[model samples]
Target: MIGFMPMLSKELRELGSSLKILYIPIVFTLLTIMQPVTLKMLPTLLKDASNLPEGTIIQIPDPSVIDVMGSLLPKFGSLGSIIIILIIMGEIAGERASGVMAMVFAKPISYVGYFAAKLIAGSLLVIVSLFAGMIISSYYTEIMFDKVDWLDAMLGTLLYVPYILMTVAITLCCSAFMKSQVGAGGVAFVLYLVLTMVPQYLGSFFRKVSPSHLVDTASNVIMGVADTHIVAPLVGTLVLCSVFIAAGMLLLRRQEV
Candidate 1:
């Protein structure tokens, strides 16, 4: 196995210069634009009542920067989820299919170094994208709501980072496992769907350990709307990441050269 430092450095250079890495910044940029537009439009959205009493008076909420984050963050995060999973899937499965995996294997680099670089790099890409979206969303939210505070928005976004990391680990495992981009993408999506809807269909008690639960809980925690009630998710995410990476490495070692 190649030394850790050189392997990591080499992997970083490969990832940094790749076209696939463009997915992160592009996805993030789109979300950034979407946030403000969605927040700015929410008030008009809520005001449109499908059915209301003739004399009823409904108060329309003026969109605020926080509202943008509140409404858009979760949704944007979901979108980012797709991009992250696809990117990871491509990094792992696509490379194997396209022969990049074989080339990497020929080098002196450890499998651990190769996969770890992608995992970390992918996470950083997600972070940058999320951060950009937050900034754009906040700027627009403030314009609409007139209650935007810079500090609150910044702090809230800071609280969002761990959740992103957790997501990276979650998807990365799937990517490493499937060795096919489509398969990894499908796995992540299915997990996301179950997590996203279970709380509404079932009771809230299941939120503790659910991956979907973690995403929602973390968002709420950041916004100060709810207490930090989903500690299980945080712990589960770490476990999930470790498990995925371990499985990926084990598989890598066993793959026929």
Candidate 2:
């Protein structure tokens, strides 16, 4: 069995040339920059919100920068996660559709190795980009908001990896088992949206575990709370992701290629 680290490195290397990889830097920068920029502009955004007719006045609750960062963090996480999944599914199916899998198979790589590479590659790209964004955002926050609550921001930011990885894992399973790039991409995207919607519409006390709500909900845990109510949902997400990965691998192994 290939060790996960080498597999991860190999996937990261392939990511360098992929057009999809380009989105990572962009999304990362945006997520990193979003909190600072939005914090600076919230008063203005609220002012705009207040101008609306009766009952539309959103109370500009005096949210500290840390509070804003907590919310913004997840939004950024979701954006990066979705884009990665779409690209992964398309790439996997595209290779198969174009007969490029023949070239991939001709190499010494095993089916399991190839699948491992694809999943790890997708996860690494999202995690690195997410880290970059978080680091940059922290830099700006510290420089400008000297009193900003560092502990809270850090807590809010740390859960990013686990949540994003689970999301990507589910998507990779979809991509791997899919027969056509379009078929894979389309099904994955729809499933992604549906997963996202469940947490949004259905009630969940533990925000972290809710598939649809994880990214945005992740920020709640960053508020210095020792235990979040969403652990159930987060655990469910992890379980689902593992199931998807195993299923995807089974499907990939069964393919004629």
Candidate 3:
């Protein structure tokens, strides 16, 4: 228990030093801020592009705050997730290749403690980054559009947390097995696409099990589109994270460090 604290602190410091801590959240916030502005100006932008007859009237409904906020998940599901994967995809595998893992494990650290510390630190970083983006987004959303219900945003954010953590866990799991960080990144990205996109067309049963459902569920909450039961997807995501973490631990144990 005492040893875990330093490991966690070390991981936190590593995350703090990483540029992704700044840039990734900034990307999300920028996406949020731009959504309402883009929607409001879409008619004008389209009209200018259309080069319609002179004095042509372009009519488009102003987007609701809910719509703006709801659009966030898809942007995040696509680009934001990719950025996160790229940032963390190297974490474990890169350290291993550089002999950092070998040096650390040579000491008396518990493998479980090391793994848990990494997971906790990574999860905390994701939560903080997501919150930073959401807070900035909410401010811009309210100013550019209408005030979104804070309660709805909070609920939506809670629902979305697991999916992001799951991505980190997947990358770490892949990193543990792959000798090359680039290979880990590629495998994680491919798996991410499969998990997030493939489930859409499958069926209700797949939707219930898919982590993508968590993002969709969050969007639904933000849009006031009514809630679906999230217990399955949420639990499934948690279970999947645990499994991935365990897999990484097992792979690390087998490796000659």
Error of 2 at 221 (Å): 3.0
Tens digits of per-residue lDDT for model 2, 84-176: 666577656677878887777776666777778778777767777776777677667667554556666555555556667776766677767
Runs of candidate 2 with Cα error greater than 4 angstroms are: 2-10, 18-23, 42-62, 144-152, 199-208
Evaluate model 3: give its TM-score.
0.91
Of candidates 3 and 2, the better by TM-score: 3
Compose the digit string of candidate 1's lDDT tens values, residues 1-257. 34456656765676668754565666676775675665556545656745655666656555544455565557766777777776666677777778877787787877777667777777777777677767766676666666565665666666556666765665666666676779878987776566555645565555566556566665565455745665676665566556666876776566653
Q: In model 1, what lDDT does residue 165 have?
A: 70
* lDDT per model vs. reference: 0.65, 0.67, 0.80
Ranking by TM-score: 3, 2, 1
- How does candidate 2 score on lDDT? 0.67
Q: Report the poorest 10 consecutive residues by lDDT, candidate 2.
A: 199-208
> How far does residue 228 in candidate 2 sit from its true spot (Å)?
2.3
The digit string of per-residue lDDT tens for model 3 on 201-250 reads 89987778789888888888877777477787888778877888889878
Give the TM-scores of the predictions, in the order they appear.
0.76, 0.77, 0.91
